[model samples]
Target: MAEALPRRPPPPTIYRSAAGEAAIRALYDKALAALPYEHAERLVETSFGTAHVLVCGPADAPPGEPDQDAELDPAKHEYGKWALEVLRGLGLVPPANADGGKGTAPPPLHMGTSFGAAVVLDLANVAPEAIRGAALVAPGGLSAVNPWAFALRLMLPAVLYRLLPCSLTAWLSLVSVCDEPAAEELEVVLMGWKHIVRYPPLPGGPSGVFLPDQLSRLTAPTIIICGEHDIWPCKATAAAAAALPDCKTIIIPGAKHFPAKQHLIQAADWILDWFAVKGLVPAATK
Candidate 1:
């Protein structure tokens, strides 16, 4: 018998956006209208605040989740442990006989975009047995950040972000990481996450170093989808593909850094197709 997923919470409210709480509610309505009504949401309490996790799938099928930013959430602050929590949350348990004999159960699968993609890669390297498969979109951490830029983030005061106008900050970030011109809606959302709202500060924040050795440890099948126009060097992504034992890389034409947000349906289709090809979807769905 299949393990039952966590029960759905009463429909308190659905919140999905990078907007400030005041603006998020409004944007949430707009985003929700575009989704099927059957979609449900739950608020996962973390040390920082309540994280809104959206759920959509069959009752019998295993719970598959897309992670939010690992840097911001307490439960997922560490890239390594975050992956294990995601698997356990989805009810995946490591097989008792995993050392040599046939394993007891299949691992959970995960998908992520941008920084979340970095977390996916980190997790795959640290705990491959914890996941069945993984797909990453425009993943970072494959290459080190430019030294000048790395110093800027570390030296710049967090208060400066609070002081800067959201538009300017968002625009600067877009130009730095994205090759394509920013769409108005995308800019607005970026501004919301970067300036309008904030999370508790991280310790020392990220060092922005790309440690290639992490990729060498992955044991599960993986797929990496990178935007041809992304500011990060494509060669770095290629190097990551070369390092992994079971991996494939796809370069999407004309796409940029934030493909999941800018080209939502298109990006999701790629991920779902990979899952189907990998047989990551539950047998019931097949």
Candidate 2:
């Protein structure tokens, strides 16, 4: 008989101590408690694999697309598409003919941050009417990032510690991406990076996924929130934003890639304002 194949190793846990684990869990509990509406967690099966997603907002609220985060999954975009269908299956999305069963209205709004922002852009391009509006935070689709923003200083060391050093690489990359204010959350961000790089869904490398030329194909109202310092490819991101027919770009002064997370209230305000301006949010929400 043929030898049995080796089992794949389980992923690493972020916390090294029980106290740390309890603390993190407490933080999560607090966050969940703060949500305006009830939420559910489930495993969404996709062609790639099972994607764990948190569904929140009113149970009767209109269903929307999934917002991609900065996780390095090569199939991130594909997962977003699949997530839309899953939301529909869960009845989180309202019926298409909810208007007294008259006719189909616009789909629900979708949003994302950082790499997720890039995924939202790609989704808009792929399915113009799949969503109503798109909101991004420190999105990465802009092709014009400065070459120096790549954290080349840590490249050699990254290769040297290639066997196991995501935390170090993540720290180096964070240093390159953030400004002074981001220092307060540097440790949190470091742990986040460690989690991301530990068993990265996708290999680390440039996917060349975002194409500025394709921005024109998007018909949905799109917004981009970026940090002035996180400006990769120099002035290219601004230029690309300007090219989009219905795009609005906002640059946070003295901020970096993780501005939305660091400045949650500000980011939330910006998002609500954008939705109101686009007539996506209700008057009460304003």
Candidate 3:
């Protein structure tokens, strides 16, 4: 008999069912409705692809203060560069200095969480003068981890997600969240577990950590926040903050890799307070 070829694994996708996508959309809409500030959706063309951006806050507010989401591709730095270019083209952010010369124009502040935070750090390393400041929450790329162990840990949860009831799986996953998850949060988790085929791995196996020299080049003021119980990057984050020329570090109590909603709000307040102290933003009225 002729030799048979090995079967190829199917490609990864965000969701497995239309129902799951709808549930996610409903949750997003609910969150949007509850926002204290208004937001507008915009599509900006970039060299790589069209950028879908959400502009929040008042219409009269200053532009170029971009908030990056965790959904960005962290495996490469091109996406971050592309986003900056898009903002520059829109006149939201100042262009880079010419011929590697430093410009006197003020730069925009950036805030990012998880993989998005990694992107922010990469940008700061490559173009330090382009960023005024940064707020990184549970940032990645601070340390190296054993890929085998990481893969095994992820596989355990995925296997349980497939074998056990979704509620049970979600409850187990809650160990990473400090507070009881809201109904919407639970629903989102359940839907994700039920639908997602494969999860993407971090950029490097045991080599994602940025060199100390690279971090030393980040001259902008920065604040890094990590959950007290976040085993993945808590220590690494602190070490990174210590290495930076100007940096602040905060650890939220009783929080894990995924902090509670209230903790997130607290972190935001801290960032804003820090910015105010630095005169980057106006102080909140009591």
Candidate 4:
């Protein structure tokens, strides 16, 4: 008997200008439906304008989900336990941030927008070994075209009022603005979880952090898909497809940076297909 994936709340609406919004939204719906629908809907209110996004999608590795979903059981994916342990190590446990330690971790980024991409990539860079197969539709890496600049353009007026000019330059203001309230709450917890102590790679000396170039260390099976028209992270990410040991690349015709948004069904199918090929997911599962 195939095990069922654990269910969560209804998914929220998603949007992205970096990709074809309608196409991406359709793709997310199809994937969630394939996973059992779980009751997601389109929403009017959004974080970013007109961008297709996926609300409440399968969260970053939930604890014990393996035991709950027999298909995710051991002897199936060796990395299942490892992934959970990393989740635990990263302090993703329930009642997140029990100790009230702020900034000890990255802000609790929800996976529905470009911010999600930045957060996920940062985390992945932290623990690449824990991941096996992955599907990155689009990301807000330095490459992904972000409205952050334009959105900032729109918010300039309200932010400039005589009352709160200092708000823009304060510590962690961007994190607060880009993240949801729940994300802010977790960011508070993160403040407590500082970097693991290590010798500094440079003269500053002994800083507990790693730089972005270290991303090349990850060799897991990864698939980076981009649309023909979407700006940023398209050509480079696709090119990086061959950089990882077990990697593949695809550029969707007439598509843009947002593959899932520009070509939902095709994008979802590609992800499902990639996992099957990697043996992380059983062929029959699809």
TM-scores of the candidates are 0.63, 0.65, 0.76, 0.41
lDDT measured at residue 138 in model 2 versus the true structure, 0 to 100:
74
lDDT for 46 in candidate 3 is 53
The TM-score ranking, best first, is: 3, 2, 1, 4
TM-score of model 3 (CA atoms): 0.76
lDDT of 3 by residue, 26-116 (tens): 7777877887777887766554455556677767654533433223344455545655765665555665543534753466788878766
lDDT of 1 at 16: 42
- Predicted candidate 2 versus true structure: per-residue lDDT over 1-286, tens digit per residue: 5233233233355455666666656655666686776677665443333455676677666533343222334444543454444444444444334442445445767787765666656656545556678787776666645555553633543453455555555456556555543443455554443333343332112553455556676667777777777745424677777767787878777776655455656777777787888888864443
lDDT (Cα, tens digit) per residue for candidate 4, span 144-250: 34345334532343344224434333223333232122433333222212221221111101221123353354466666665555544356555544445666667
Ten contiguous residues minimizing lDDT sum, candidate 1:
196-205
Between candidates 1 and 3, name the one with more favorable TM-score.
3
Error of 1 at 270 (Å): 5.1
Model 2 weakest 10-residue run by lDDT: 196-205
Write the residue-wise lDDT of candidate 1 on 106-198 in tens digits. 666667666666666666655767767877777776765444643443223233445674555545555544555456555454535543434
Candidates by lDDT, descending order = 3, 2, 1, 4
When summed lDDT is taken over every stretch of 10 residues in candidate 4, the lowest stretch is 196-205
Worst 10 residues of 3 by lDDT: 2-11
Top lDDT prediction, candidate number: 3
